[model samples]
Target: MLKSSLNIKVDRRDAKLVMAHFYVAFIALLVGGLAGLLQVLVRSGKFELPAGIGYYQILTVHGVVLGLVLTTFFIMGFQLAAVSKTAGTFTNKQRTIGWIGFWIMTIGTVAAAVMILLNEASVLYTFYAPLQAHFVFYLGLTLVVVGSWAVGTTIILKYAEWRRANPGQPSPLLTFMALVNTMMWTVATIGVAATVLIQLLPWSLGLVETVNVGVSRTLFWYFGHPLVYFWLLPAYMAWYVMIPKIIGGKIFSDSLARMSFILFLLFSIPVGFHHQLLEPGIDPAWKFLQVVLTFLVVIPSLMTAFSLFATFESYGRSQGATGLFGWLKKLPWKDARFTVPFIGMLAFIPAGAGGIVNASHQMNQVVHNTVWVTGHFHLTVATAVVLTFFGVSFWLVPHLTGRKLTKKMNKLALIQGYLWAIGMTFMSGAMHAAGLLGAPRRSSFSEYGGAAQAAEWIPYQIAQAVGGSILFIAIILMLYIFVNLAFFAPKGEEEFPVGEAANQTEKAPMVFENWKLWLGITVLLILFAYTIPFIDLIKNAPPGAQGYKLW
Candidate 1:
């Protein structure tokens, strides 16, 4: 099935945009990773200095730059590329606008990055009400979002245009998912953007005496929940649609992939209030509603995991992988997508299985702001997003650079993947255990606490630092591998093979296109969520939010 060449045309300009997005995201992640490293060092008493205002400012810059800007922008560009090919669509004009959005967003990013480096705003990147800031941060984020909003429009218009010309055909499910994600971003992000523009700016300039804190967190998380999905969908797209194709198996259920995306669009936004479980003032009942919906959110994630694992099993059995677990031995461990995500998913199993326990009503009191929560996010985000990014990087690198990856380079990258998974497990495990023993999360340092708490964290902190170093070393090796692949490696002169998956394009089943089942599923979910914020006498709630307004 591996053909050396195929007729598919890769839009080189589009490919450049893809590279540009990652270059920014990866570098930003590196900066954020360093800030995280410092927090770890400070906690361990390994170093101390007048990090002072610079420390807090860097923390804000780190979160905004990496968690928001980098993740959003990169996924935006990648989705555009993936949708174009599968949908048999192209966007020459919109692609140009998309790149322009990239530049505008970039300028805003640089301006914001510089301002924070100078310690002008220490707002901690949260839109916490009454915590005002200088106008520059707000303005920079405005310009950035405006440009991205434009990019999103370009994507939607192109998809619509294609659908019109194609007559009565349904769009490729991914193209539909991309546009849904775009619409979600447009609708959801406006909540925060509105706060920054109308509310925060005017208030910071003393135009208003106060804004609503309860209102702010609610609107903010409405934006925040789907934002996680925005970062995540690109990874999930690869997982469901592309990975199976890449691995030489029919997707276990193309319908399931589409269903999952639809479920995400409906459910992801409402669940952000789960993070507000510990915060005062928000209605406890409303938070409980969100918590129930949040648990429902895990259902689709589980669906995707099973679908992918089943595909893995099929691929393995075909390769003569024997017995129940024997398929594990047969995976192309050298393939980045298969190997990295496989291990990352394995890492997630323990952490996520633990999360179900942690998310339970009573258990939340046990580990709410402790290292357990930290460990869970690491497993989900790192395993899901970052590992998938590595997988896609392998798929795209050679095509982008016009060189063959040396076998040695591929093996090196695979080795780095294993090292990453192993190191993350050990470090996160120690943190989770420490969380149970009363270690707090998000502290700049563990200094002010009592001996019992300090004693619990001492060993884990050291282990975490060691894990960080291992991860750093692995990243350094990847930089070397990419350098060789992009510049130093010999040009094959033989036309590069089309993506390994394109040749298997037999007609896919339309199992996902069925609407009635999804309609029923969505209705039931809405009922469950509606019940969340309601106060039945049978339901217990804490003060200030017990009598929540359901509508």
Candidate 2:
């Protein structure tokens, strides 16, 4: 079993499908990174966008391309490759479905990109109503979501087949993680889909003259919070299963990992209300309830933190390290695969703390709609999740492409990771400080008629510009490494590492595999959290707002 698992590589055909996703993802990174640089420079109050280009247009491009296009494509591709490798190769039908999904998503991405470039759609990633886009943008995003469903269908089908073949065993850990994320995404997206199809699309198309802004936003946050976790669980998969193998250590506990994932599935969805603590239309009681549920998610997060420390310490002790902190010295700091994601882990400490503050109703008021909120997610998604994705790419990209990650490239990858950390420290740290001093988020560079408070934000904005410049350099470096790994590297096999548990004899509970129970509870929790609040939003909504082409 060990030998077979170790030797498993994504099949050649599946590799093409997965690589297709990465290609689009990297292209998005280039476009979005440029947009991000422009955004910071504009906000610095020291630069102007030539040709009368609006700052918000570039902001929209940065947010949508990176937050939606890059993350979704990369995640779908990674999950597909993982399932194919661990659960046996996809059947011909499954692979075909995967290809079909890929095309639909690519087509959708192109359509949306065209609209954004044309400035017909600048609603940003959240696409909030009252600030409408061209209908084509909505349709394009719809197709992206629909395409992901098709890809997710393949994962589900593959998992079903694995269970049928194995009878009583737990599914592969990576495959199971993929399934959890897919299911959570599927459930979560219904909110966005509903808002788009029922509210935004019609309003944009002029079939509806007005949209209930409250309900639209409510539905959005329903999808929004879990979207964070959707980006995260794949990183967790790497942490729980892949990192151990990378570091030559055993998984601390397979059961612990699965249980944590199950908890995430249960708790991550019903907590979207925490994002709307300040919004009217929802009862404060409902918001409070959701906030409590949001805090529950911290349990699993802490569980993961505990499990990782144990994994590291146990591995360190195994190597004859004795001091309480000796494990820190024992880790493979030179190996980019381990070091890059580890930096992400360190970032999460602050990220999680910020999340707690954001979820607290009173505390949220202090930073609500402020750049601090923006700074918080930068750490979570941009640092923690993205760095892990990059780490995964250092190996997974080459593994799929039938190449080795050359030693020179590995060293470069480390530099890329460290550069990202430094750049984010300057950018996000300044954003947080500026936010506390009354800076607004999602705004163009403005002196506010030379207001004193606004004057205070300029220096931090300049710091952000400096940081953005450094981050853009790192992005270029990453893209270069990706190209080498995909094409120019020497032809060789790269191990697709999947770690064994330290206690292999201990079987994961069958309960952990009971999806019916888990999904049922997930639905119950979401319904309990949102049903009344949603009804209140619809029934008590104010006069609807007409669409505005703000740009």
The model with the greatest TM-score is 2
Candidate 1 ranges with C-alpha deviation above 4 Å:
1-7, 49-53, 125-127, 354-358, 449-452, 492-551
Q: How many clashes (backbone N, Cα, C below 3 Å) per candidate?
A: 3, 0
TM-score of each: 0.86, 0.97
lDDT of each: 0.67, 0.90
Q: Global CA lDDT of candidate 2, please?
A: 0.90
Residues 330-379, model 1: lDDT tens digits: 77777765677667667667856866766576788889888777777667
Question: Which candidate wins on lDDT?
Answer: 2
Checking candidate 1 for backbone clashes, the offending pairs are 255-512, 283-545, 289-532
Cα error, candidate 2, residue 191 (Å): 0.6
